[model samples]
Target: MKSLVLCTFLLISLAGCAQNNKKEMNQNYSTEEQEVINVTDHLTELMIAKDLKGLNNLLDKDFTLTHITGYLQPKAEWLKEIETESMKYYSFKPVNRKIEINENKAEVIQQNILDARIWGTRNHWHLQQIFQLEKRNDDWVILSSVASIF
Candidate 1:
């Protein structure tokens, strides 16, 4: 009877440990996802603020932006538009967001309603943006993006 009780106790203890480890793993994934989300939020904030220096730090050297009109803009041209106030963003209302991470690379899809003025014309647009990011030197940087208007 004593041996039986001892074996049962050991089994319960092991099960508890397994449960705890699983919970820890789930928490770790959640933390990683949140970190990615925070980086994306900061990117939008920088765009709205027109912080060119901050944007420069977040964007990779080969960053490219594909517009809804199917035109591709390199980092320099995109930065020039922001600097010249040609693409002015008043606000962004995120409708849906999804993120996927694989090792050091991540992709984020965001659907948003944007209140903006482009080249002196006021517009409210429903936009879908796909952002690709890479982790470099312990920092997350935007690698490229494609944007479409719906």
Candidate 2:
């Protein structure tokens, strides 16, 4: 009977320790996710503000942007389009967003409803955008953006 009691106590103690450890690990993971989200927010803000310099700084040189219309844009082309006002977005509101982190890489999925005027044509575009970010030297930068039209 004593041995059984001791075994039960030990099991209960170990279970409590495991639960505490899991909670701590979850908190740490949440913090890491927040960091990735912060970088993603900055990228979105820069895009909405049309901050060319900020976008340039946050986007990798070899970054690629793929549109829902089956068009692919390289870094230079996207930058030029933004700089020359060829692609203009009056407002971009994300309806839903999710972030996933794996080691040094993060994936951001954003569902946005944008009121944009592209080449003098007013349009409401609902887009599901996936952005990949790579942490380079502790700084997260956008590596790719792929979108789907809905």
Candidate 3:
């Protein structure tokens, strides 16, 4: 009984420590960096929700998506694929983020566990997406995203 009680206490303490560490890591970023991260997180939400209009508004006119296979998909075509459910995103969870800002431009490397169906194959993919963004008229616009397996 004592061993079980001790183990339970240790588990609870470790969980609390993890929560504190996550909060501390988030606090390390500046307000501007958080804004950029928000845009990227919003993109994941939009993707999973299949919000084509929202995605379109958040992205640049000349945006592109580079797949892990080295295929560069143009914005219109990619949106069309999503609209047609060819490239369907079911859910996503962001696990890590890194953002760098220079003037009005930023680069965000976000790691996610993404549940998606692409070209008829469904899998939970560990994805690392590098997104290029630019601030325009007080709003951030995603310029492009290149995806790779992490």
Structural similarity to truth (TM-score) of each candidate = 0.77, 0.74, 0.86
Candidates sorted by lDDT, best first: 3, 1, 2
Instruction: Candidate 1: list runs displaced more than 4 Å.
Output: 1-29
Clashing residue pairs found in predicted model 2: none
TM-score computed on alpha carbons, candidate 3? 0.86
- Summed backbone clashes in each candidate are 0, 0, 0
Query: Which lDDT values do the candidates have, in the order given?
Result: 0.85, 0.80, 0.93
Q: Looking at model 2, how many pairs of residues clash?
A: 0
Better of 2 and 3 by lDDT: 3
- Return whichever of 2 and 3 wins on TM-score: 3
lDDT of 3 by residue, 1-150 (tens): 999999999999999987887687678999999899889989989988889999999999999999999999999999999999999998886678889999999999999999999999999999999999999999999999999999
| List of clashing residue pairs for candidate 3 | none
Q: What residue runs in model 3 are displaced by over 4 Å at the alpha carbon?
A: 1-22
Candidate 1, run of 10 with poorest lDDT: 22-31
Leading candidate by TM-score: 3
